[model samples]
Target chain A: MSGPAGGGRAGSVLALVGNISARSLRVWQRNRDVYFVTWKTNLVPPLLEPILYLLAFGAGIGALVSEVQYRGEMIGYTTFIAPGLLATQVMFQAFFETTYNTFVRMYYQRTFDSIMTTPLTLEDVMAGELLWGASKGVIGCAVMMVALSAFGLLRYPHALVIIPFSFLAGLLFAGLGLCFTGIVPQIDSFNFPTFLFVMPMFLFSGTFFPLDVLPRWAQVLAEALPLTHVANLMREAALGRLPADLLRDLLYLAVATIPLCVAGIHLMRRRLVK
Target chain B: MSPVIEARALTKRYGGLAAVDGVEFSIRAGECFGFLGPNGAGKTTTVRMIYCASPVTAGDLRVFGIEVGDRPREIKARIGVCQQEDTLDPDFSVRKNLTVFARYFGIPAARAEERSRELLEFMGLWERKDARIRELSGGMKRRLAIARALINDPDLLILDEPTTGLDPQSRHQVWDRVRGLRRQGKTILLTTHYMDEAQTLCDRLVIMDHGKILVEGPPVDLVRSRVGKEVVEVEGYPPGLVQHARQSGWTFESDTGRLFIYTDSGEAVFTVIAHQFPSERCTVRTAGLEDLFLKLTGRELRE
Candidate 1:
C-alpha cells in the first residue's frame, strides 16, 4: 500500500469512508450486549441524577429564590434547570462512553485489535463506537426525561423532541471525547480533560442559571461550548416555545458533529492502524 | 494447487528500524507451516502482514491469490487468526465469545449458534459455555480463543504462539486440537519460540533470527543436517576433553559449566568422552530441533 504521501487529502478521506462497512454494527452490538448484562446498575444513575439535581437546586435552592426570568418570562427555578439537566445527561453519557469505555476496549481489553482481524476495519470500529456512544446518550436522556416529566418540569410533545436531539448532541460530545482518548498517553491522563473541559461545561453551560447572569466575556465563552447549544435547545423545547433561534442551534450542532466525529476517527486510526 | 500465502521480499519497517527485513517464504494449501524465532525476531510481524493486521512497508504479499493491500477484507474473512495476546472478550461467557465474534464475519445468528456449539464441543469447552471469562482457567481461555478463531470455519488458521503461557497439559490439549484441524484438510500457520511445539506440530518450518531465515526444512531433517544424529553433553567444562574434541575436528559448543558434542554415533562419542574424562559426567542423547535452533540462533537472551 502507498504511504500517506501518495494519496491526496480528499482521496484518503474517500478511501477511509469506503473502508467502513456494515460490520461496524457488530461493534455496536457487542457494546449493547455488555450494557444489558449489568443494566440494573447502569439504569440507576440516569434515573436518579436529575431528581437529585431538581430536589437540591430546584426545591431547596429554588425555595429561597423567587421566579427566574428566562426568555423574558417569569418561570420557576426548577423548570429552568430541568432542560439543562437533560442537556448535561446527553453530554455525560456520550463523553464517558467514548472516552473511558473506548480506551479500556482499545488498550486493556484489546477489543479493537481483535475486531481488526475480522472483515471489519479500524474505520468500521470507530464508527460503531461513535454510534454506540451516541446511543448511550439517547438512552440516558430518555430515562432522565421520564424522571423530569414525573415532577411536571417538562412540557408534553415538545419535550419529546429532546430524545432525538440528545443523539445529535451525544455524537458531538462523543466525538470530542474520543479525540482526547486518541491523544492521551495513558488512562490517568484523562484527568486533564475531565477537569479542564467537562467540569467547566458542567457548571457554566447555563445548566443551573441563565447565561445573562455571567459577565459579557464569560457569556460569549459559554455560548461557544457545545453543551450551551444543547441546553438552549432543550430549554426551548421543554417550555413549549418554538423560537426561530432553534434552527441556529440545530445547525451549529449538526455542523460541528461531522468534523469532530471524522477527526476522532482519524486520530484513533493513527493510534491503532500502526 | 497454488500456495495459500506468498511473500517476496516482505518488509515491515517502523520509523528508522525494520522489524521484518526483506523476508521471503510461501505456504502451501494443506501443510502445517511454522515461523520459529525468539522474541523480537519478527515472527509475529510476518504473520501480521499475511493476515493483513499490519500494513506491509514494501513487498509483494498475496493471500488466497489476492493482493493483501488491495482487498484485505476478502483475505481476512477466509483466514482465522489466534493472536499471541489474549484478545478474547472479557465481557462475554465461553459461548457468547464465539457467537459475538461470528457477527463480525456476517455470520447469521442461527448459524453462529450452531457453529459456536460445534467449536466449543471440539475444543472441550462445551461444559463451560455459560461461565464468565474470569472464572475459567488459563487453559480454558486459550481453548476458547481457538474456538473463537474457528467460528468462520476458515480455510487457513494462523496461530501466533497459541500455547505460549499454557501448562504442559494445556499445551498438549491445544496441540491435539490443532492436529485435529489439520486432519480435516485445513492449512495452518504457526509461530512460536518453543522448539518442541514446532517439532511436534509443524510439517515444514523455518528458523528465523534478526528477521532473516537461517534454515528451512522439516524438523527431523533440520536436526540431522545441522546437529548430526545425536548429542553428547558433559556436565562440567573439561579443558583436556575440549582440546581433544577440537583437535579431532568434531562439531561441538562450549558454555560456562557444560559442553555439547554432536556426532552421528552417540555410543562412539560417549565412550571416548567417558574414557578420556573419567571424572567428568557425560550423557549421549539423540539430537532434536532445539539443538539446531540454538546452533543457528545462538544462545543469547533477547529482550
Candidate 2:
C-alpha cells in the first residue's frame, strides 16, 4: 500500500494480498442496511428449500429406505440426510448471495462502480461481499437447524457444534461463487455455474446417500469435490463428536478459503479498477 | 498556489479506440471549470480519469499535486463525483443515502448524521427524507445524488452532466446549490453539452471533439474570439453566396436551408447581405456560445 512516489510505480501487487482494510466494513454495513429492509422476502427460499426437501425426502422416501448403514451403526434415514441437507442449505445460500446478488450489485446496480469512486479499494469491496455472503449462508443453516430440531433429527445435543462449522461451509462456497463471478462476462453465463458446477456438486456430494454406496472410481470422483469435504466434516460434527481428522478438515477448509478469496479479489479488481 | 488538478498528455484507450488522447489542462482552485463537448467527445472519460474511476493508459494526471495514475485512494478521499447516471442506493431512503456515503469517506457517525441532515435540507430533499428511492421522481433522485456527492464536504466536486435530464425548475435548483458550493471555495469540474449551462456555471471550459480539445477559454472570451459579437441568419442561399462571402472577406457557415454569417457589428454587413437575398430572408441576432460550439464541432450529428 505504498503511494506512487516520484520515479517508481506503486508497491507491487503481491505485497497487498490479503490486505483487508477497515473500509471493507463500510461495504458490509451498506449490505446489512439493505438486508434489514428485504430480509423477509430474502429468507423464504433458504428457509423453505431444505424443509421441503426434508418432508419430501426424509418422510416420503425414508419410509422406503428406513435406515442407512453408518460405519457399524444403522441410523434412521432422516438423521442420515439431515446434516447433508444442512451442507446443501449453506451451499445454496452462499452461492446465491455471492453470484446472483453480488453480480446484481456489481453489474446491474453498479454499486461496486459507485463505491469505487470512494476511498474503498476493490479488495475492500470484494472482502465485504465475501463476508456478507458467508453471513447469509449462516442464516440458511439456522433455518435448517430449526427444521432439523422440529423433526427430532437433532438427537445429539453436541450437534450444536455443527452450527459453527456452518459458517466455514458458507465461506467456502461463497469464495467459489464469487471467484466465478470475477471473470464471468455476462449474466446469462451464471447458468453455467449453477448447472455445470453448483448443481453437480449439490447432487454428487453425498447428500442423498453414502459415497461408499458408489463404486470405487465414482467414490474417488465424489471425494474430489469441495462439498464432499464439508459434508463429511458436517456429518461427523452432527454425530455429537469431532472426528479424528478434525485438524485435517480444518486445514482443507482453510486451504479452500484463503486462495479462492485472494484470487477472487485479484480478478474482481481487474474488472473494477480499470 | 498550484492548480487543484492538472493533466498533461493524459490518454485513455479502449483497445485501438483512443477515448481520451493527449488532453492537457489545469483547474484552478475556487473556480468552476467545465469540459464541454457533444456526446462521445471524451468529456466523461477524461473526468472519470480525474476522479480515479478510470485508468490512464498513458500520460500524466495529477490531483491535488498527486499523481492520479496511482495513489487512487488518496486522490479519491479529497474529490467527490456525481456520475452521469443515477447510482443512488435503492435500498436506503433519501437521508440514509447521504449518511451511508459519508461513512465511505470515514466520517464518524455523529458527523455523518449531521451532514446527512444538512445536505438533505440543502438539496430540498428533507421533506421526503424517509422515502425509498423508487418513490422519488427523476428530479428528486438527481438532487439526492448531488447531496450524496457533498456528504464528505469534498474540496473538489465533479458533476458529469448533472442537469442533462432535469426539467427547467429542477435544473435551476441544482444550479443554485452548485453556485452555493462554489461560494464555499470548492474547486468544481463538470461536463455539459448545454451551451447555456456551461456559460452560466463554468468559469472556464475546454471544448472537445473526437477525443481532442478544440478550444479552451472563458465562455465570453471564446464567444468573442471564435464567434464574434453578432450573427445574421438568411433563409435561403442566393446564387454564388459562398463566392460572394469569400470575395467580400466575410465568413459564413451554411446548413441545408439557412446561412449563418458572423460579424462583430452585423447591422452594416447584414443590411448589405440581406439586400442580396429576399427581404423576408434575413434576421440578425447576437452571437453566443452555441454558435461557437457549432462552429468548432461542425454541424454533423454524432451518435
Candidate 3:
C-alpha cells in the first residue's frame, strides 16, 4: 500500500536481471510466509525506537533550541529530526535482513541449500534475498511515516514519497550487506564492518543533525555518505518541496546501486556456487 | 537396460587433495544401486558431484545421459536428492517445507499443495503435517526430507547415507519406504555404511575405499567372491597360531590385531578354531559385506 514493494522489486535490476526470473519471486513468497509468524517482532525496532527518539530529542530537547531555519520558514527541531529517523530506519531494517538473516538462513538453517537442490539457481536466491530486504525496508519506512504523523510532526502528504525513497535506500544497504555476507567466514566478523563502517555513517551522515553545523572538513566528508543524500531527500519530501539537486542525488543513488548489487551477487556466488 | 547414471574416471579435488579420484561406475535403469564405504571413503563426495553440488574435477559424469557440467539445471530438474545432512527449513512446517520446495521446481501452487498432501500421506506424515521442523523427531525429519525429495516425482532419486543416525525402528520404516519405492520401479542411487541396509535394499552395489572401487557386484556374489561363503574369527591368537593355520592350508587373513579365517567350510574351520583357541575366543558366521568393508577400508578411525 505504501509503494515500498515497487522500490524493492526495482532494486534487483542492477544485479544482473538476466540471471533472475519469475522463479525468484517464489523466494520472496517464502519469506512472506515467515513474516506472518514474526511480523510483531520485526516491526519493533524500526517502529518503536523512532518514536522514542522523537519524544526524547524532539520534545524534551526541542524546548531548549529556539528555532531551526528551513526553506523560508523557522521549523521546530522535531520536524527536522523526524525525516532523518525515517531514512535511518530503512537502512537499519534492510541491513539486518541481508546480513544476519541471510547468514542464518544460508549457514545455520541451511534454507538456501534446501532451495538450491531444486531447479532454482544461486542467482534466483540472491535476487530473492535482495527483494526481501527491500520489502522490509519499505515496510519500516511506511510504519515510521505513520508514527511521525501520529507525533504531529509530518508536514505534508507529499512526504509519502519517502516510502519509495526509503525502499531504494533499503536496497542500497541490503546490497552492501550481502557483499559482507558473501565474504564473512564467521558471524563474529560482522562486528568489524558494522562498527567501523555502518555506525560511523549513522552518526556522521547528518542523521541526527544537519551537516553544515559541523566543521567544513567534516561537512566535506559527510558529502561522500549515501545517508546524507537520503536525509536531504527525505527532508525535501517532508517540507513539500523538491531539491534543485534532486537529479544529482538520484543519479548518485542509482550509480552506487550498480556496483553494490553486482558485487553482492558476485560475492555471494563465490561463497555459494561450488 | 540403459544407464540412469554413468561416471567414467570422475574425479573431485579440494585444493591439492582428491576427494573422489577417477571413480568409474554406471547405474542401470529401475534398479537400486548403492555405494558402500567407510568415513572419508568418498561416498558423500561422489554423490555431491552427481547432484551438481560440486563440479567434477576430471573425467566424464552424466545423469540421465545428459552431461552434468554442460546442463546441470536440466539434469537437476529430473533428479531428487536426499543429502547427507538434514537441510530442512526450521522456519516452515512439514507441509510448507515440501510445498515451498515444489515451487522451486516450478510446480504450480495448486499442484504443489496436492502433491505435498500425497507425499505427506505416503510418508506417513499426514497427521503431523502441521508440525514445525524443530518439533519432529530425527526419523520424522528424515522422512519429511524424503517426502520433499519426492514432491517433483523425480525420475532418479539419490539418497546419501539415508539412515545413518536412525534407530532400528526408524531404519526399518525408511527401508520399508525404500523397498516400496523400488517395487514401483524408481531408479535409485544410494550411499551408506550400513551393510545390512545395503544388503537388504540394494540389487547391486560397489564397495569403495580411498576413492576407488575395491569390489562391485550383487551382495551375495560380492560376499562369495571376496570373502567366500563363511568366516571364522580366532580372537587373541598369537602370530604363531596364524602361521600354524597358514602352514596347515587354512585360507585366512591376518588383519589388525585379529585373525580372520575365510573358508567355504565353516564347520571345519569352527571346529579347528574352537579346539586350538579358547572356546570363548572362537566363533563362525556367514560372510557378508561388513567383512569385505572392513577388509578393504581397514579398521582405522576416519575423521
**Top candidate when judged by DockQ against the true structure:** 1
Across B1-303, the per-residue lDDT of candidate 2 in tens digits comes to 999999899899999999998999999999999999999999999998888777788888899999875677888998888989878888888888888888889999999998889988888889999999999988888889988888878889999999998899889988998999888888899999999899999999999989999999999999999889999887767657767878988878999988888999899877787677445478899999999999999998889
When 1 and 3 are scored with DockQ, the better candidate is 1
- Over B208-298, each residue of candidate 3 has an lDDT whose tens digit, in order, gives 8878888888999988988889888877777678777878897777656678888899998787766776544777899988887777777
Q: What tens digits encode model 3's per-residue C-alpha lDDT throughout A1-274?
A: 1011354545544334556677889899999889887778977877788879977887788779745775457777888888888878878888888999999999998888778777777778888998889889898888888888887767677787887888788888889899999999988888988898888888888777767678999998888888888888888888777767877777777788767877898789779766
Question: Which regions in candidate 2 have their CA more than 4 angstroms from the true location?
Answer: A1-19, A155-157
Model 3 spans > 4 angstroms off: A1-18, A70-73, B255-257, B275-280
- Model 2, A83-119: lDDT tens digits are 8898888888888888889998988888987887899
**Prediction 2 global C-alpha lDDT:** 0.85
The best candidate in terms of lDDT: 1
Residue-wise C-alpha lDDT for candidate 1, range A42-90, written one tens digit per residue: 9998999998888898778988875798878899989899999999999
The 10-residue segment of model 3 chain B with minimum total lDDT is: B272-281
